[model samples]
Target: MGQNSSQGARMTSSVRVIVVGAGCRGEIYSQFASIHPERVQVVGVADPRKFARTKLQQKHKILDENIFEDWHNIVEREKFADAVLICTPDRLHKEPAVAFAKKGYHILLEKPMATTAEDCTAIVEACTQSGVILSVGHVLRYDPVTHKITELIDAGVVGDVMHIQHLEPVGFYHFAHSFVRGSWRNEAESSFALLAKSCHDIDLIHHWAGPRRCVKVSSFGSVSHFGKENKPTGAGNRCLDCSIEGDCPYSASKIYLNRVKQGHTGWPVSVICPSSLPDIESVTEALRTGPYGRCVYECDNDVCSNQGELSCDGHEVHVFDFLTQRSTKHKAHNDAPRNFGMSGHGGADYHLMAAFISAVANNDPSHIRSGPEETLLSHLLVFEAERSRLESRVVYCGDAGRR
Candidate 1:
């Protein structure tokens, strides 16, 4: 089959797409849409936050009529779109996805598909029933370097996959900015760090190791550094209000001010100052008062700063959050030397999207590598691992256990 005909129709024009959750990932997806207009067109965006939606429209030059605050509003009014990109928080993925799938729309869903296995199954069922293509966002599987590693392993370049070690050095400032003081701080609102952050790692491990039955799994994590007990004495209630804001490295004002200075704009900035707190003074004040600027130690943040060790089959995988530093490295079985490391976004998102676009254009499931079923298997493994860690017992990989 050629790269443009799932049904008998040749796709001569762009595929219409609606992007939900105009946050950080949404912006990136919008940029990709702009770059690949022939194959993808971002015709609509849905986000509840006024500032977020406005920023997405302005950044992408999308028309006001094409923007929506409520995702359901868009689904109810618009009859069709080739696909819907769900970039909402981990907890918010299900509803929009279920709705879109039922409408027979192909979906490019963000990672950690949903908080639980049931939600993930529901999404898979919805898409299956409607005959829509459902591709979960497991971007790492598509990354160039990662893909090379996988290819090498598949081709017997890597000796029989023995063990895999993956390290996600959740950077110091990044931990404070996103995981600690950011939107993902609370478990109820988001999820455990494993599910919210390292679903990619779990997915990658599953891809490399094949469906290995999880023999034993355990994890231990806690909000070690970012809890009230760790709050510094004399720490003010807010960053702007704090007397030692300049001395603190995790200061929201300092971090975002630098982000803006470097032309790094989007969800990170809008998250700190969601409204017109127009001037720098207001912005700083807003950060101090807003959720983003609160003292990491004093805030209501409940997610862990350090989670460690999940073993599947005999392959033990370890994940850590060094809140005081930033570094990332992964070692997978491959024909190559095996040691691989990278500095930035880890190329996960870039790779994942490329594969999804290619798969859609090609209209082949094999081309669409990261399907909901495979990704869900990895997600279930993580959930089981967390359970084992909490209950202090071995947990198996549900029905999707190693085939």
Candidate 2:
């Protein structure tokens, strides 16, 4: 945190950036430029939604000529910025990443790199060929806790690093919001639950494993909680019309409206309704019509809410768990006000951006922890783990790249 900020300010000129996909991730990364005006500046933005892109356009004072409704438009035109932040949806990553890398723009692509191993490889290859810094958005690597863990292992405090067990509690309401009714509900639409929600865990495991490559991988998971068979007998398709909605733990109204009552109109609330200061009526209307209101048990979501994967290098074992269950109560949002600023992902988002800016400003790739090759390796592990889950067999990581 300390060095990343000072390193960012060392540049002669702020690194001009183009933000593609002005959605939640897009907005989070774009805010970095606003905080450090001398380090980075948002010069262009591309998004299909007027409501989304307009926010960045106004906040960053981006010129009309630089605003684009499609990323293809940005690719066609001459590259205007030194770097591009590819925060597009999961399926849309490879094309934009490859194109932008070919265009010679240093890229900060969001996690999971791409849906397929081949696509991920292509992005890495493109960045390698173009000789531009390619930083995948593995924000967890920059977390203060993660750095401490790395230091302990490095300093021999944790002697002879062997097996590591990790758990990613995706949380009940959060799972319903993101993996059930939200953008990442289905694997085909986005990715499997492991890749979509818990890739961070996988990457972190890889980081701790260090040079000991995962030789054998096997995984298991299913949509046990949110399937149609689990829905209440008298439940309505939407929470608004449901008779037993209030008693349900995954109720949309209970989730979003309660947040509004707590004066939290950002995130899970803003995702459903576009209004800045959405009242109860607007949020209710959004739940009534939008996909967010759909009953968690009735949505088209097929990804597993509980997933487990085991990877080992023969001697040491690593266990991964992605558990999302019905909770009795949701945690209070103590940091809601600062949420609009840099406090996302335990403040790792800000650190990741700061490191990226430092790398771009100084033309030094070493500042990036999750660079192309390492990211591709971790993504391959995720893909292989999924294959092992579906196939019910062990998958050798060495065979992952060939496949």
Candidate 3:
């Protein structure tokens, strides 16, 4: 990796950064910051979970005073830093982002921007008002593979970008862990599958096709497999206590119990909560009463595990999350479908961050290559698709003015 010489070759001269949400994405940001100490220094971290904050502090050697539970408090108490990384859940991005932006801090916002378009618009307004460098974390735009594809398409290797197709086969294990068994299990909490998991796809479609207003869209989906209706008769109250754990494909005991045995420590255990009576009683109690502990088959989760359809611009995308399946992949097509292969953040978040960082350092929006205006079109497409899915008809994405 090339070093950022402009920031000086000393860790002390690097941009002082703080990360909100010490979860998976936050951890990744911290690790990246740690590795490039000369370019970025993680000065603070915030998460409600004590374990998450403690682990991040220990991992990155952040001072105890800088480990906070609430990011708002951090922004309130501390002077403006060079940059802030908002790695919180989709729903929680707006507040901290708006807060830090007003403080004249450059922002690295996580994707989906917010749970709703209105919230997203508000965030954009806040950033614009503050004149802070704001970059959304739609990282797929930065992937070498994806960048190559974009180049080929621009070069007319893929003529006219006619009716692009994409697939997010959210590998079964990933689907189970995130959509079925993790923080994103409920639509109320996460908005919907499209926004929560597939916003990157929406963003990508906008990026490739130019600003053709999404004319029509439709979506169809069903929970299909994971729910109380599908649970076996006489199934135990919890996966760990279940008698037929071996027979069931979504056996928490088999997946998480074995995972814990293999030394896979971190949020997954707290997220999945395999044991009815967990080794850590506090975590078990938290799961029992909180959204995380509910049996995947017994939660209030209504988002479809399998969703697919076409957008008005003739672009087609399919998202099949076999919460019960095992592998994941993303495929895109110009003339025919070409496998782009699997990625760490669905190939979106990482790519988005790299581009945003480069843009900030370069002081150029053209280098951003993607922006809210373009990403918002994809958001509209998804909205239209959801509408069509419910109404059972094609919906067109009309020229809704930039939000």
Candidate 4:
């Protein structure tokens, strides 16, 4: 209900930020600080990975003294920046978020606040008690396509949204690289695949489904593919040694090495190799030894490949399986109409970054579309959906008395 535009735009100043993780999300969001140097500045950074830390430092020109391997080194010390951007892995979010929030650093915490509800509550409490601005990375709200669709629904252009069908289409190689062979491969290591990957979709759908609170929820899914039973008969544990790897679509060599050949050295490549610009030799060596080298079917992964019937507030939502065939990055057509159709997912990333900065700059929590309360609602849906999936029964999603 408050002003959405930058009416109080601070044209002459910038909000200082300290990036606590130099991974993809952290690095990309921090680029906003660089892009709008007049509105934001990167004063500090903390990331454990040498390559990621160095890449961000060189990009932002952060002083050597301001960069550290651990977030505690800065959060434990004096409050150095106006904001702390926490893009650490799923399991690592709570502590840095709580630490920074308590220190009066407004936070930009990544999605799925935490794996457990308790940790999420603790973080929300910390931010509320500290009187800090806490915004979640629900980038869909900032996405133009999403906004257009939301406007259409609200304006009655598409009539009523009685039922919503949303597909995440977590592409094949991407699934194998991240869910099967990468950091989010296991539930224990990171989180349920739903919370880790598709919380944005949940929040987006909920936003579009306004006024109608989710009264009931249910879900059904499993590790439908990419397990030991699905492994090729002649395949070994690692792709480098497997004689049948050339025929395997899920081969790490086929994915990462192909990226190497195509001059793709950033994300999926950097994740496997230890360097920013990885060489063929380093990638091959990594395939021979690292987690990325493991056969998708033979790894310790347990998250579901395709989730079905993820009903939120009694509305059925479909979450698709990861593809192993063609890979598609979140891209937009150059000539596409801006407000008429969909924009690629990548565009929303920076838009969310800008929205957060503007909110901080103007001291308006209303500027960021997804605040702590809305984020926690989506997280609750994630947990309830998972519970319903495992328990084989419909679950109510009301806040308190309805439950």
Candidate 5:
């Protein structure tokens, strides 16, 4: 309620922005502008989904003319905005971001920045050339607890972080929802599992690794557990028709109905059902045909459910999962980053957005802790890790922090 109340509040913003993609990430990050009217203004919004785009429209009181169906239209018609919040999918980020950067708009892009190494470089070059502040979303570094950890390490409180045992146990159901059945299901479609999911931990590991650059990297994981062989003998292709779905932990009914039990249908549910559909019927039909409703063990998903033995800086972390569900257990002692007069006054993710808005407001890059260059190191680590996995040999990631 505290964060929601902060979001609902109205204030004036020096940094007015057009939301380029009205998906989950776009709305969550850019809504700060909607919430804190003083720090940021949601001037325009663009998304392929009309309902999603219109939702942002109603919230911000934006004109019908300002709501666009795609980034292409916004760039063609709208001459300028103070900043562009590019929250499109992994594949779509580079173009809208580079376009707006050239248009003299500061950018707050979502994570992985761009899927490809080349695309990432293009984004960095665009911002550098355009002289617009570019802050890729690396929110873990902005979290207060993470901030405290950063402080502790800097102050020698944690006996010198010689080795880190990080794990992103992205929760079984969540992994199925986002990575298995959802947008990031395969390497060819969006990105490898590592970049799409665990870039946060990779980035965090790099942040903690600090000056200790990786000399060698190797990774090995596959779709061993969640494959056709693992599918139960009596299970149908979809959850709706599947007889054994009740026993399955990753069943769609178990996932979405529980949300219904909680008196809300956000995220995983919203993803399965269209934004406009009633939860029960929508989810039912989705199970009948949609990708999300497919049996977790039966989907065409190829990303690794688990990978480990991340050897970095002479330290061997035997297991590190995507998005860090288990690493959270370590947070009781090890805290995250702290805030110092953040611009929009939100949490780590929100605060990072705030810092970007504040940086735009103050015209100071120092306001943001991680910019394009810092983000690149983490992305490079992911690339090298993937390379190591594919080539089956140690890839030398010389000077990971030296970009």
Candidate 6:
């Protein structure tokens, strides 16, 4: 579990990759192949949706024989690639991860490893036992802003990292779209709001804490705004049919259509429909019948609209706010080099993919920053924080939680 240096090793050959899920995250991670064809190539892809699979195939020039309608089809075949990117949904991570790891394919699993602690541990064990590299999707670790913050801390410019306060602004429209009426709306279907959305925040906090374990954790949050109890007096079930849609801040029409009108039809809009380029008609149709079109308060979302978690090891303290994002003016960040393209997650996506490709190509685990054990530890902390929030008590991590 060595931390990869930003200077990745030279690849002797392209690292062949099989994408297990062709959804938004899958599409984003696989774009690395298009950027660095000599270093990485997508050899296979699997998705239940034909649109997703076909979209990835067209982008990466994947063969029709290699394209699969289901991940199980990929797993059933003999191992045909050097590595696998398990970008499946939150609940669909473990099976493909274990299967690919057992097949001797190094893995790049998306964040929160799995929905539960047991499943996370199982995926880790499978990879560890198989002696294959497992890198989790903690993309923020590779972001330039994060690197600057850590560099400042290490240089003692912050003078003893005893306390850190962090805030992540899950914007109103974003929260309404992703958490209130989207795939991760229900805890049973996806995960608790914190783990589903803020695992990266917890992982960042854990990374900053450095070697100190999160021994004690207490959290507070609940479904505050986007619940049936908060529905407007005369609001319809769906935004398209609602009379108050024009006045509501979380209106689907406003959020989706406004972005289209602004010529910003990438994310949150592309996600609403199966079309590669979602237009006004497709968007309107999706709103008229799809989950994204539902009224925020009338949806079945149960995740917390706002949440906070506090972690301490009896000596140092860390605080995380999952609602507000305040700007911090820092000279170091302003002066940091911008070599990586700021496309996805401030270009951390490119760095993470580069590191993983280099790691697999050279058979060197050090090329990855978020190794399996490190990712599992951070994920455990997140689960504990969620537990504390639910039970309304501080939970002690003791020996296991420590590094």
User: Which candidate gets the maximum lDDT versus the true structure?
Assistant: 2
CA lDDT scores, all candidates in order: 0.71, 0.83, 0.65, 0.78, 0.75, 0.82
Model 2: how far is 272 from its true place, Å? 1.1
Predict model 6's lDDT versus the native: 0.82
On a 0 to 100 scale, what is the lDDT of residue 168 in model 4?
A: 77
All-Cα superposition RMSD per candidate: 7.7, 7.0, 8.2, 7.0, 7.2, 5.8
Per-residue alpha-carbon lDDT of model 4 for 58-152, expressed as tens digits?
98899999999998899778877899899998999999899899899999998879888889888998999999999998876765556555655
The alpha-carbon deviation from the true structure for residue 296 of candidate 4, after best TM-score superposition, in angstroms, is 1.0
- What's the count of clashing pairs in each model shown? 4, 0, 15, 4, 18, 0
**lDDT for position 53 in model 6:** 92
- The weakest ten consecutive residues by lDDT in model 4 span 332-341
Evaluate model 2: give its lDDT: 0.83
Per-residue CA lDDT of candidate 6, range 251-330, in tens?
99899988888887778888899755698888989989899998888788888988744332222223232345443345
lDDT tens string, model 2, 1-403? 2344334545778899999989889999888887778889999999998888888899999999999999899989987899999999999999999999999999999987999999999999999999999999998777655665665566555466788888776678888899999989988889998888778889988988878888888888888889889889999999999999989999998999998889887778878876444779899999999999999888999898788443322122222222433322212112112443524766668778888989998898888989998989889989999999999888777754446
Give the runs in model 5 whose Cα sits over 4 Å from its true position: 1-13, 275-278, 308-346, 399-403
Off by more than 4 A, model 3: 1-13, 266-295, 308-343, 346-352, 399-403
lDDT of 1: 0.71
Better of 3 and 5 by TM-score: 5
lDDT of 5 by residue, 1-403 (tens): 0132112223344678899888777767766754557777888999888888988899888888888886888777657568888888899888988998888888888887988888898999999999999998887777655665666677654556789788766777888898889889888888988888778888888888878777777788777788888788999888878998878899887887667667666666776665674467676777777898788888878888886323222111122334453432223122212332122212566667767877787677776777888888778888889888888787877765334
Model 2 clash pairs are none
